[model samples]
Target: MSLRWRITLAIALVSTLVALALSLTVHFAYAYRQAEQARQLQTQRLELALEEYDRTGQPGLRSQLNDPKLPDRLREAASEGGTAAMVTQTPQGAVVWAALSTTGGDTLSLRSSYQPQLDDRASLDRVLLMGAAALIATGTGAGVVIGARLSRRLRHAAAAAARVADGDYSTRVSAAVGGRSRDEAAELAQAVDAMSSALQNRLQAERQVTADIAHELRTPLTGLTTAAELLPEGRSTELVRGRIAVLRDLVEDVLEVARLDTATELPELSDIAVGDFVTRRVATYSSEPEVRVATETVVATDPRRLERVLANLVSNAYNHGRPPVVVEVDGPRVRVRDHGPGFPDEVLAEGPGRFRKGSGGGHGLGLTIAVGQARVLGARLSFTNADADGGAVAVLELPVSEGEDAPGR
Candidate 1:
């Protein structure tokens, strides 16, 4: 359940429990007080009847004993005990008090019919019902209002967190509540804002360092390549040339990654047939991935960047996997599967990272670059092990270009 409902439910339950406790307390207290007052009044009436009997020396002197208003219980009390009192309900739901006493060996009885006046029990029940309803309404309203307010604030914090996760380092939680009232939630918002600022600073610093290193290495790297080309044709010269090429490529890849981190490499989106793009890119590789196109669709993406992504994936498969790299295009989605040992547990779990190589050769920026380009294209890139064979399967889901036919399932 959402936070709003959870908190509201808790408040409602507590309110009900408190109301029930108080209602029971009031009910019991009123019953006890009424019982005590009835007992004292009955005792006084019985004492007066006994005094009248003592002075008159005649049972008939107290005419109420003979009257029809007297209850049968009072007559029974007079016959059974010399002194006693009782409150009882009659067959018609009427309440009565009965008492018996003796004076000069003459039995005397007393009674008083109980009929509520202004403080009738039925009217009290109506009042109690209204009060309970008002209490519940007030408590429920307060819970909803409070729960909604808290939910709004928490949702704002959660949205800011989501934006930060989505690579929007500029996103920060607003600490508006701090100025008026600094509650726990406001403190949490402040903390989130601080964390976002820290992340932005650290990531920007890292990107700047990478860009600086790449820029510094390029001048010497070009000079070294030119020197290697001038060297006489020999084993040593060939080895040096090869190593220089590798170093140059590494520098270039680092600069590209730094650009991606800074989001300076925006996609030049264009309409390209998904099937054709897959076929042409696969042809560039020597391993020649098996291509399958079922229900082709067009995608809007930067062709060069898309080619780069395909090249890196195919290269990884050929170098690391066993054999038979298969590339399948279904609608706007492409899948590359290799029949080899699957991706490393860490890569599959933690996702690809720059400089973090898998169990393969070469610098680890290939998958990282691919992922970054995919983001620029507003597409999704995922890696998983094939269900049947435990081989790495990379899927790229691209957004459909405008005015293109919708992709079939």
Candidate 2:
């Protein structure tokens, strides 16, 4: 539940409990007080009656017992409508003989007048009433203070979250209950801030990479267009042709990276002979011969994405490897090894952290694009320097599917 609502609920519950306690105390206390008052008042009436009886010893005084309307008066007072009672004994010896009708049912009458004394007050209504009021008031006050503090904390956290949502990652809530601990709200606020900060950093890095790619593509494009002006005729023309091909490769890599980076498409999967797939990729990219052997290797994978991955890896190796790219297939596994100067230490350390090339030539997004395509096809990509003597090894493991790679599944 929201903190605001919880705090409000807590306040309401405390108030209800306090009110109930007070009501019970008031009811019990009023009853006790009414009972005490009736008894005291009855005692006073009894003393006067006894005195009257002592003064007029006619003995026929039983009929005119000092009070003709005493029973009705006592009954009226006792039936105060708040506390029920009987007119009970007044504790005077011989006072009963002086009495006439005991409408109080004779159970409350005394024999003769005795010395007046205070009754035991073991259960004082006043003390109980005061105690209940004090306890309830104190408890309610404490609850109010706690709820207020909790609400304040929630408000602070809510404001911080709103600021973060508005793209302000620097926003933070204070971890204080008048300067103490940062509760659950504060922790959540802090987490949101951290996540926004990290996302912002990543976006900035992507922007930089985008800018670099645009600049690199522009130069190659201009060169290819400028060289196209010279007609295809001799050795110089052949050089221009090679340059044109390189420019095309660069353009294709750039487009591939763009697609990989923002792919909103899933791969079409199929069960393909892994060895044959490897042979096709090797033949497509490698000028040097490639080898493929069939094994119990079958994988459900998108052929096009797999092809792209193999093409990129092989092209990368051909550009840098010494010669001879070897392709091998195992159970749901494929490996491409190059007899090149392996991979640069820099490339190995960074591991597909886009736009880092050691040869100082490639678009550098080739391996990154390949890796992304592999991921979309539910595949794995790995790279390692083959031997201590230097050469690059690439592993691509694709999951086998039951159908052919095609459009619309």
User: lDDT for each of the candidates?
Assistant: 0.78, 0.63
Candidate 2, after superposition: displacement of residue 108 in Å? 66
TM values, all candidates: 0.88, 0.46
Candidate 1: residue 129 Cα off by (Å)? 2.9
Residue 239's lDDT within candidate 2 is 79
Q: Compare the candidates by TM-score and give the number of the best one.
A: 1
Let me know the TM-score candidate 2 reaches against the reference structure: 0.46
Task: Estimate the TM-score for candidate 1.
Answer: 0.88
Query: How would you encode candidate 1's per-residue C-alpha lDDT over 321-405 as one tens digit per residue?
Result: 8689999999989998899998888888988877886666788888998898888888899999987977899999988756776
Worst 10 residues of 1 by lDDT: 58-67
